[model samples]
Target: MIDRFLDRLAALVEPTILALVIILLAWIVLRLTRATIQRAVARALQSERLSAREEAARVRTLTTLAESAVRLTVILLALLTILSIYGVPIGPLLASAGVVGLALGLGAQTLIRDVIAGIFIVLEDQYHVGDVIHVNNVSGSVEALTLRYTALRTLEGAYVIVPNGEIRIVQNLSRDWARAIIDVPLVPEEDVDRIIDILRPLLAALPSDPELGPLVLEPGEVFGVESIGQQQATIRIAVKTRPREQWRVARELRRRILYALREAGISAPYPRTVMIFHPSSPQPPASS
Candidate 1:
């Protein structure tokens, strides 16, 4: 009877110690992973090549995403190892998990797709928070991003939630730089050369303006006479600016163009109307 009891205790003891060792190793690995991730992010952000704002935004976003992925993988692997050490049949467990996964996949395909898309988006560096993007016909600045969805804030202050899978096309307006393109329409009869000459000085001076100097990266370019319609001629001016600065720069540039045109006495095209009034026929009938 004592021999049987001793044998039973020994078996219990071996499994318990093995389980404890597995847990301890998992804990150590998790701790080291966290520390390594933190150090990598810190080092990246501290690099002197990027501006403070750029480093902060980019590092913070990518770091959060990377840590999330790593933690999930570590936890899952640790769970599986612990189960195997406890003599749980991994094959049967995996089979059951597969069945459950299939059911979840059928029911939650959209969710799974979103997660996969988000991972790709992050890995590819498609865009990040604070970047202005147009997706699914909704144009907004990315306010937040996660593995499931992205939150955007439009110019009108409306918040939009977009699932990663639903985004078929992404137009990222704020990446490394942005462009401000403005079309100025004038009467077709106006001299295109005169307009271009008038715009040259004004556009050229944009980069020198203290307020716009930093924002404007590329020198202004005027594409003269973009199109000449019957009534109007369009002159296109495009300028490069810092990311997300194009909107303000474009708006201000348009305002300046309008003011310059008015000062120069340049008139825009207007629809013409011709009226023909016939009173002679009525007067002749009355006399008769």
Candidate 2:
């Protein structure tokens, strides 16, 4: 009875131990290959003078690809190893896997497309984490980008997951520099040249201002007067700033311009009203 019990234990334990050993060895080999692949990809991307964000995106893409490949390889090897131990035929298994893979791939074509498109996006640097983008009317800052999909945090703080294939056009708003455009309306009677003259010196001095040295890429300048209304003319000023700083520059410029206008005693124009009387009210009754 003891001999039978020992035999049963051997039958169960030996195969399990052997399978585990093979799995461990396979995992080690896969890890080595994965590391090598990642290093090669990293070196290639580094030669492009990419920024840290770009580098991180590339590394993530490569790591994901490597992991997928390694997992598939390990799974196939483990299956083959176990089947050999059990004396099962592998020719039929390979044929069956081919058919099954084809069916599965067909059913998951959209997913595959999203993954492939996402890879291209990462490699091409279409956008990066922290970039503000407009993808299919879902505007937000990119919180995370992956081969499967992109995660964005909307301006309202909602998290949105967008499939890569569905993104037809990508508008990246935070690339280099953006324009800070403001239109100031002045009384038509005010001298245009005087306003321009006053603003020119201020704009010229802007580049050297310590407060604006880093934020302002270029000095503000009058683009042109857009329109002259009945009481006022709209003056257009444009400033170029580092990406995502346009709004800040605009607000600051507006505040400063208002202060300057007040200091100069320039009164901004206001709406003019015209009054008309009905024929019936044109004549008033004589008072006693």
Candidate 3:
């Protein structure tokens, strides 16, 4: 009994040690792979003329995907190695895995499609985590992204999850630069030329503002008389601004313009209705 127990213990020791070694090696490989992926992505994007923030986002995105793939592969390889060390036949296991993978692929078509789409999205750099985009008629800022889905935060503080496979015709609003177009509606009786004159100086001085100067790429332009309706005439003003600055600039400009118009004694147009009542003398007399 003692001799038999010793033999069994001796047999188990070698495999156990080998398994631990394999696990350690896998950990080292995972770390190295992650670091390498990061370096490679950073080097690849260096020539793209992107801003530091943009480049860092792209590098982080690419490295995360690459590292995940490498980690999964290493874990599988390590697991197989440990199994084989214990006299487990890996050939049959591999064959069974292939069959199971085929079944899963058929049943999880949507998952596979999403992953493929995600790969393309990352490769193409469609958008990054801070980018405001409109996808499938839902507009929001990207909060997180993964192989299966993307997370967005709407302006109203709603959280949305979108499967990557369903993304089509992405409208990226936070790319490069944006334009703020403001239309000021005035009473039709107001002088158009005079309104333009009033607006021109205010628009020109926007870039000189200390708070808004850095965000303003170019001085605003007043496009006179966009349209003329019965009640009002629309005067258009457009200003070029940095990415994501359009809305802020537009709001501030509108506020200032409103105050300026008020100070100048110019009031905005309002809907007016004239009602005419016809006298029904014969019908009233008949009723009485």
User: Which one wins on TM-score?
Assistant: 3
lDDT of each residue in 1-288, candidate 1, tens digit only? 999999989988888888788778877887888778777976966754766666667776777777778878877887888778768889998999999999999999999999999989887878887778999989998888888999999989999999999988999998778899999999888888888888888879988898788899977899877888777879999999998899899988888888888898997778766579977654455554
Model 1 Cα shift for residue 155 (angstroms) = 1.5
Backbone clash pairs for candidate 3 read: none
Candidate 3 residues lying further than 4 Å off, grouped into runs, are: 227-230, 277-288
Candidate 2 C-alpha lDDT tens digits along 1-288: 999999989887888788888889888988887888888878888888875765775576666666776778888888799877656889898899999999989999999999899888877778877778889889888887878899999989999999998988999877766888899899888988888877777777778988776789888888778899887898899888887777787888888888888888887789988689767656687899
Clashes of each: 0, 0, 0
- Give each model's whole-structure lDDT: 0.85, 0.83, 0.90
Candidate 3: lDDT over CA atoms? 0.90
The window of 10 residues in a row where model 2 has the poorest summed lDDT is 57-66
lDDT at position 198, candidate 2: 70
Best by lDDT: 3
Off by over 4 Å in 2: 18-42, 51-94, 185-191, 227-233, 266-288
Residue 47 CA displacement from its true place in model 3, Å: 0.8
The 10-residue segment of model 3 with minimum total lDDT is 279-288
Candidate 1, run of 10 with poorest lDDT: 279-288
Instruction: Identify the runs in model 1 with alpha carbons over 4 angstroms from their true place.
Output: 1-38, 42-51, 70-99, 276-288
